[model samples]
Target: MTQQHGKKIMIVTAPANGKRFCGETNYYEQLLTAVANSGGKGYVFPLDKNPMDRKGFYWDAPNRRWVAAFCPIPDIVYNRYPFKIRENKLACKRFFQWLDDQHIPCFNTAFFDKLTIATLLKNDAVLSAHAPLTEQLRSLEQLRRRLKKYPVVFLKDIHGAQGRGIWKVVRKGKSYQLHSQRKVFPSLTFPALSCLLQPVIKQRTLLIQQGIRSLKTADGVYDFRVLMMKEKKHWQCIGTGIRLAAHGGFTTHVKYGGKAASTNAALLRPPQAVVAFIGRHVGRLLDASYPHIREFSMDMVMDRNRQLWIVDINSKPMSFDENIIQQKRIRKLVNIFLKQGV
Candidate 1:
């Protein structure tokens, strides 16, 4: 094990087999560059190749290729493993256990399930106030009973992301309507809710949540993506961006035709302080519940009444824009890694 620089930071992510770079490779490059610029070294590697007995494979930058080297175990690891890859492999489980045994600090330790997050928030006094009415749907009867409580509801897969596998159910007069990004099923006057959702649910557990009517513009509904990072042991809001749903879209997801723009000070209705409060509270809760989590990305929405609701908590959050990375938050994060000592 060799430490060329003061510290070695390893980014654990999925492998890009045949391509020049995967979708997440650019983000890893940015992270590595950041670490290098700050006088440290970084590399991206996949879990399968990371052996417990020896130094694993990592990207070699100067040579511009993947190379095998007996590099030192990283002083810090930032987990960016995609959920699909992590779920399908037992290697990922072992990798995390190895990290724990080695005492290597890693943030975004594991993927967060939507239902688990909702249940945790509901149990907290401060967080529950901002959490929507949510229930786990186990059967058709539960869905039918839940529909009677809210005029509009959202059926979400416990492990879904990128706006996929989500359905908006609206009660229209005597009938029900189901809306998705690409299609809409109108007048779902079925004998039972199971008839309509059984195929969609299909061996997956769903969460029935009261639909929130988020603020919208001419483009579509919008929400705030707040990036939070731990600075010297305390969580703080680093940057925020406004995500507008794409035309005719029901959810504001960047991949789902949603457009993200830097937050405009003039357009901030509830003030940045309020948003920070929400972010801080959620960050604290997550940090306390899940050890080794030093960062989070919170999808928050404000209704017409100016009340904030936390919609999603992303453990393995997407990389922020360059401007966000240039903020003091990133500097603090890097400093923490450097202080860990090689």
Candidate 2:
């Protein structure tokens, strides 16, 4: 009932016409190279706007380059298309449905919702200890109640990505202050806080989460991007890299002032075992909904007390910055998809 996947793989960079390819050309090249070296062949293509069944950029392994060549429908589809909105379009949805009709496998692409992920993790007894207390802020009253419990709380977009607009609300005695980006608003009363957040909630959903005092870097707060891949029997950890937030910044997002570093993997050794355990649990959880999900990535942080917390998870993981981690991940991925033959 299913199409037997071959070694030939189709790597989709975007819904249509995105030569940028996740803005990590080097990573793309490496993946293609790995596939080539592994004896399985592959091609890179845009998801739409082109004849997906017949043309793509093939790897010129000998010359160490990509060549414009005619391609056939791949045995497997490895979706690298990262834009959530584009992938949600009617046209894109139809294409994915078509893949389903053809029985061609595209392992993952259910763009994660932060609230759903947090709530699911919070509900799991084994994972609850590592999950921060979070709730959907449907109204100012909800946020006010949360503030009563946690001294500092964070507001994150339910559907947001790359750490955008994650604001902080810190309670100083009876006064509350909202911190957005680098700007810190003056202390406000409960009514004033309600007024400020009313428009935001009206526009989109925001989840208020318990803000733990995390380990700080010289730049700002930092967290580990734990990369994990799904194998047939278990989840394989690719590697971990640290992302340091920009000075006085709220998140460790590279597009913002945050940057990646190899700083102190030793410090994370103890928690990584736990992280791996959680990854396996998450692998099973996601696979249930996504069917045959190949992999996922997690954003984790260590609190000042040296306790690890699970902050986020994404099915469509971006490439890691650390060279070694990226290299290891590519090899593991190639082995997974190319085991069958091009």
Measured by lDDT, the strongest candidate is 2
Candidate 2 minimal-lDDT segment of 10 residues: 15-24
lDDT of 1 by residue, 163-237 (tens): 877888888777888887678888887465447678877777788888887777776688887888777677788
lDDT for model 2 comes to: 0.75
User: What TM-score does model 1 achieve against the real structure?
Assistant: 0.88
Give each model a TM-score: 0.88, 0.88
Q: Relative to the unseen true structure, what is the C-alpha lDDT of residue 181 in candidate 2, on a scale of 0 to 100?
A: 72
After superposing candidate 1 on the true structure, give the runs of residues whose Cα lies further than 4 Å from its correct spot.
1-5, 20-23, 49-71, 84-88, 262-268, 325-329, 340-342
RMSD of 2: 3.1
Candidate lDDT scores, in order, read 0.73, 0.75
